[model samples]
Target: MKKMEDNTLVFIVDVKVNKHQIKQAVKKLYDIGVTKVNNLIRTDGEQKGYVQLTMMLWMLPMKLGSSKLSPIG
Candidate 1:
């Protein structure tokens, strides 16, 4: 977690989503004003050999207001 100028803490989160949903997820983040996405990796799922996306995301502080947000639109 990194501290911001406002003395609030931010967390770096690793998320995995179905490959087909990557675009939607990233777009949703952008809409919420979060653009600090880190390393993005693609891998195969263990069970059905489906493509999966692993990306590093930034978690904003609670003071930002929208806590329960969904990246899928």
Candidate 2:
């Protein structure tokens, strides 16, 4: 399974993964609603793209489980 840090709405994702796919993935994985998703493609970089999501729709249990994620430096 993929691990994500708390306080982060952005994720480095696959080049082929589109907005719809990402939305579906997040929903399926977290079982929460998504308001919007912003994607930025970066070429010739170690990471392909950055995906931003809103935290407006979140599940209490899911958020609780994510507490272990350390803050990004």
Candidate No. with top TM-score? 2
lDDT of 2 by residue, 1-73 (tens): 1213432256678777888887788778766656656677776652332333355323334565764544344
Candidate 1 Cα errors over 4 Å, as ranges: 1-16, 32-73
Please give the distance, in angstroms, between residue 37's alpha carbon in candidate 1 and its true position after superposition.
14
Which pairs in model 1 have colliding backbones? none
The alpha-carbon deviation from the true structure for residue 26 of candidate 2, after best TM-score superposition, in angstroms, is 0.5
- Kindly give the stretch of ten consecutive residues in candidate 1 with the minimal lDDT sum: 46-55
lDDT of 1 by residue, 9-67 (tens): 23222445443354355446543333333333336422221112232323432433566
RMSD of each: 10.6, 5.1
Which parts of model 2 have CA positions greater than 4 angstroms off? 1-8, 45-66
Once model 2 is optimally superposed onto the true structure by TM-score, how far is the C-alpha of residue 73 displaced, in angstroms? 3.9
Q: After superposition, how far is residue 21 of candidate 1 from its true place, in Å?
A: 1.6
